[model samples]
Target: MDMPRPYRSVLYIPASKERALDKARSLDVDAIIFDLEDAVTPDAKVEARDTLKAALKEGGYGARAKIIRLNGLDSAWGREDAEAMKDAEADAFLLPKVSSAADVEALAAIIGKDKDIWAMIETPMGVMKAEEIAAHPQMKGFVAGTNDLAKELNCRFRADRLPMITSLSMMLLAAKAHGIVAIDGVYNQFKDDEGLAAECAQGRDMGFEGKTLIHPAQVAVCNEAFSPSAEEIDLAERQIAAFEETEASGQGVAVVDGKIVENLHVETARKILALAEAVSAR
Candidate 1:
């Protein structure tokens, strides 16, 4: 099995801001989303595209996965944006407001199958059709756009996120079922470390691979939150060892921390260790 890529802190940098892009090179982030849609103003769209192209050509991202967020295909600059970045050395292309499998298929056709496609599950239709979209061969991940989803649902944002529970669960289930990574939406409040931490923990518990971030300050917190704790690593090692010992004895289960550990549990424990190693290697 392929190890999961660490996406605990996916930072979004506006393509129009050269200095921001420059600063991002040194930040300790797992991934960077060079945003071309909402972050770039209408007047600066063309300029942002040019700037992003030049930045990609320079190439100093190192281990961080480079992703470019494209505007909606219906937007004026969408086609041109894809054309500009088609040759760029980015990891994936993120399509905004993806509502159906056909939307992903159309973009995949335009961008070709070499690059991974990530869909934004923000709209009601997008949530409803998430399964079809997640099952697309070209789609590598699903990003929950909670801000837009909130607007579409006409629900108020709350710290508890009670309003978004169902939608988030749907996206998570779809991604998990399809074996694609599911990333939680941005926390928005960059200064609220406590709030961000709580949200990050919540996302992690919800089976999200990571959280999208709007500011660089949120990187460390998100990384720390999503990573396997030292205690967790220790437990995983113990679980694996016990399970193996039991299997050698012709048993199918073992006990770890007063709980039963089976083959499937061993698989999950191994994955946790694999993820930790992957992140450390990066």
Candidate 2:
């Protein structure tokens, strides 16, 4: 099983703000979402696209993935946003409020299949139809638009997020089923490490590829949460060694920490080591 790139900390930077874009170049984040949707007011949306295009052309973001969040196709800005960014230097374009496969298809039509898309599963309808969306050929990722989903569901923002679990799981299942990246929504309490850490743990345990972020302060915590710990890395290394030895002896199994290590376990162990190396290289 091949693991995709780690999106452990994807920080959203407003494309309209020059300072924010410049500052993001230095942030210790795996990916940067150059947002032109919710972060920009109508007056700034058009100009922000130009600013982002220029910034990407200037090229100081290093190895961090660059994703541009476009406004909805139904909105006034979305089409033009796509048109403006089609030639921009970005790994992918994130579509906000994607309801079904058609929504992704529409964006794909405009942007062309050359670039990929990350759908924002924020609405009730979107959650229900997540499977079709994830199945889209150009759809590469899913972002749990938790804040918007909560608002749409008329649910309280509880720490446990009991009300939103079903929807989140649905999106996760769809993404994983389609071999796409599954990213958890933002933690608004950027200044609260304890709260952020807890939420990051929840997302990681839920098998999210990473957590979408709103602030630079949240990166370290988010990165740590998704990363394989030292102990985990050590165990993964030992598991690989043991499994290799077994293979050399023509056996199909090994044991690590007294647990059965089979082909499945070796695959998982390899992913852990790969993720650790990716984090270090980032």
> Estimated TM-score per prediction?
0.97, 0.97
lDDT of 2 by residue, 1-282 (tens): 444588999999999999999999999999999999999999999999989999999999998999999999999989999988998999999999999999999999998988899999999999999999999999999999999999999999988888999999999999999999999999999899999999999999999989999989899999999999999999999999998999899966788888988888888889999899888877
lDDT of 2: 0.93
Cα deviation of 31, candidate 1, in Å: 0.5
Candidate 2 Cα outliers beyond 4 Å, as residue runs: 1-3, 251-253
lDDT of each: 0.93, 0.93
After TM-score superposition, the amount by which residue 11's alpha carbon in candidate 2 deviates from its true location, in angstroms, is 0.5
lDDT of 1 by residue, 105-184 (tens): 88877888877999999999999999999999999999999999999999999998999999999999999999998999
Candidate 1 yields a Cα-based lDDT of 0.93
RMSD (Å) per prediction:
1.1, 1.4
